[model samples]
Target: MVHHRPRTRERCPLWARRARASTPLRTLLLGLLLTLAAGPISMGATDGGGIGGTGITGFGPIQGFGSIFVNAREYFLRADTRITVDGRAAGRRALHVGDMVVVRGTADPARTTGWADVVQVRHPLVGRVDAVSAGGAHLTVLGQGVRIPAGVPVVGGDGHTVALHAGDWVAVSALANARDEWIATRVALRYPAGSVPAGVPAVIEGRVASVGPNGVLRIGTQAVRLEGAAAHKSAPAPGARIRVVGRYRDGVILASRLAPARPALGGPGRYVEMEGYAVPRAAGGLHSNGILLRPPGGKEGAGPTGIRADRALVFTGRIGPDGSLEIERMEPPHAPELPHAGAGGGERGFGGHGTHGIERPELERPRIERPELEQPRIERPEIGRPRIERPEIVRPEIEIPQAQRPEIPEVEMPGH
Candidate 1:
């Protein structure tokens, strides 16, 4: 679940690795010892075979058995690749499609495919913060519930762990326990109002228009590049649904994960779209235009501040339990008078406010890699990381000289 108020597109992804054991007792004992030596053990769970390779980590839905598509890159699994469910060892066959997973591995130089040692069931959500509990332990995004344990990295656009308020967009990966409750990690925040974000985190769900060789494709107006060996080797034609997890930097979305998408219907609900100066309570101090225009059965909060106020900004999302429109997505500003739209009014009670931006006639899309794929090179998992044994520590014995021991012998003679 991803929510956005306004601004941006596309991003990148990095991943992690895994290892398994044929010896169950060895695996367990190693895990226990490592836990005692280290700390709490989490996914990729029990800690054995932590030798060599790049420690790549990423989170998203599983594309298939052979890969975990994270953002634009794919993480390939090796014969020794390991699997874990909430920190416990698992069989490779334990996972399925549509199940969200967080992968840790070592990536190749090409930045596409690499060896993954660990994969776990942990779904991530990127969306507006509908509400936060008093202590901030529990929060809601769109409508999905999330629990933030201690030390979870909560970042803001300016790169700080500022207090999260309602309507702030965030991207967080979560693990569900036996009770199906969510535990969050890798939490990121949207750039604050009026600040240019260095890295824009995003999740895109749409149909792939084309899949070039080397795992690149076009989705909506954005170009997505994939990395991994043997992942969706066949080209993706138009209408091949895909879901992307990545960051939007410069203009490209470097994917960290990828998965197939099934058509979903938003059940019967009241929806609204708005374009205006999303004046929040703080930005304008109380003069802000918060909740500008809400219908009787609708809810309204300030639109995301990421959008420039100089133009017509549009926001669309569903209403949450608190009656606030949990913004699910935003778009680049467009002309006011679209087909079926009015001069200053709206078709479905949406109100277009403020004059359009004065600057440019068109915002150019970023040039992205649309190259053909090379036959993916599948290297052995232990390619770069070698199992070098640690040298043992030894101490040499020192002999005491007779002269040095003489003073103690003389004192002993006096005592005798």
Candidate 2:
């Protein structure tokens, strides 16, 4: 069988100026050269290179070389030596499958099978797209601009149309053109859904059925609390309508403004219609916790906040003995009988005992008794007795002598 001889290896010239060229172009040239140089050397080879005398075929494993195969003529490769494909210099040509190649080596004559060393193979140029620019459709390939042709389809991350303007990010793929730019075959955009709705502020409306210790409102299947200092007026009654303005989260709605249905009136025990979930109390009664009931027509009120009732609303089947009203069933509001005292005249107010008014009697004073005193009389002695005592008196005598003397004198005178 006739065989073509393998060519000798040739040295390639290397220069620093080649390395300084743009990155993409340099890579392309390097790949092309390698492909051409290796292509022909692989094609011209006739048999496996000669470690053994057996002829190498496409079937089974070939020995002594990295790879081997049979061509139309006799075995071409006989020994191990580096060679080139076609007439291209070694290390300067690109190689690929099905390209003509030639290998040069010492042929073994004594062996019954022909063999030669595989030195190279041939290759062809394939196009590729590298990168896209910011806010521009132009692409950089092999370090050059590649304008994208029109009518090329652009897809998003979800494989839909890439509807975006400038500054939107995307990925692109295409064919490389003469100017080193890629002719975009496809483009894809990426973004997130569920972003905040534009222009409209969030508003909620519902009835305030119950007020928590922290001032959260129990609406239908939702709890409305305030995040900031909310201007809250009289609380909405169990059946009264309310409007709220604030943020919504999880099953809880936060209120920035809590306003009752009517601004003109305020009192206790008002009935407000509300929708919410019935939370069973641990002590055996049902308490409605979170209620989500929005007002009609979505109108703004005096700083009122609430939840929408369009979604699911939960109700507890029975009200417990703890004075908490349980939802037996959820239906449109009807005329409800006001709670009153029972037939036995039981207490009227919620959880209040019966009423019976009667005054108590006054205390009496104590009485004391005194003992009587007797009078004593003494007897007087009766006696009438005359006892006379004689009086004793002593008289003096004097006048007889004087009379005698006077008579004597008269007689003497008469005598004279």
Candidate 3:
């Protein structure tokens, strides 16, 4: 009787054997990695693409000036770049460091710098200084209360801080707090108490309190008569923020222009950078002004995670269809750089135009570019890890002779 010898199973290779044991787990981990990588991109997060073609709009304080820096990025101003300050045409000489501005332009892929097509600076409060506190820390303008905290600069046309007194025709650059209170960034003396320049248009921004027939709009205690094209157009709805530009006569503003105070940055799918303070949200994520910012997944708050809620930050992201900003990255804003006096006699300081000693009002023009001054470096504090200590483990001693120990068989366990 001939019987075939039993064939033994061939041993698999070491690498193959190990891979076989964890194949399912590895596949699961790979799938998780892919999902995480695609989260932001799928949510319309910009990869910083479209260097010259993509439009970028941002709102932030002017950090410095080569052309101008906003939201930590330098924006190169053009010769015809339309600039407006409080609904009036302005030049680069009108821009100041630390002034909050809105820039609409196109940036490179890195988003570090770009070309500015339009720059707008809007002062929240522009009217006669109603009352100044005894300590000069608080004031009221146009019935709106304003608070001046320590270190908040009160700048004049000469770039020096001036004492604020009652009945001064001043313009206040400020940010409204959550309580709708104005916190002054800077108080500018536009004109002396009774020396306001004639032909300087009177501008006021406020919510529309009421509307009357024949193009009459009331804001607070002030009444505005919208004329010309502004009157012919549809009147702004009540509660809408409106900016009126015209002259004041008999306690009423004869408005030649009426526009929205805060214009929307861009439409859906537009990339935008915004700088604002973070406030915790009830649902999740954080709130900057009225803009909602969330991480890629929207599962958690994007801020207070390596970011302080009290501090301001520049958020880089895209505008969602619902007007929310899906935050892709965020960084602390660059500190405001104070302009230094140039060495020449006629040359102005670094912030404004340097006319080289000639004083001509007609010659005053917007600066397309300027030499970049050395800005003081800001060093970040280093974080160190704490050392951990583990308790020592001591084994009990059992004196046993090695030769008298019992023999045990070795067992090979299969990999899981």
Highest lDDT against the true fold, candidate = 3
For all predicted structures, in order, the TM-scores are 0.25, 0.17, 0.58
Q: How many clashes does each candidate structure show, in the order listed?
A: 46, 69, 0
Residue 293 in model 2: lDDT: 21
Which candidate gets the maximum TM-score versus the true structure? 3
- Stretches of candidate 3 above 4 Å error? 1-53, 109-111, 197-199, 212-214, 277-313, 322-324, 329-332, 336-416
Off by over 4 Å in 1: 1-123, 157-159, 178-180, 193-201, 204-416
Residue-wise C-alpha lDDT for candidate 2, range 257-306, written one tens digit per residue: 65542211112221122222223333332223222122222222211123
In angstroms, the error of model 3 at 322 is: 4.6
Query: If both were scored by lDDT, which would come out higher, candidate 1 or candidate 3?
Result: 3
lDDT comparison, 2 vs 3, better candidate: 3
Q: Higher-lDDT candidate among 1 and 2?
A: 1
> Model 3, 15-65: lDDT tens per residue?
445565477887886788788888754422133323434788888666567
TM for candidate 3 is: 0.58
Writing each residue's lDDT as its tens digit, candidate 1 over 258-374 gives: 765421112233333322334334333111112332323433433344544432234444444544445555554233222232344211111122221111122356899989989
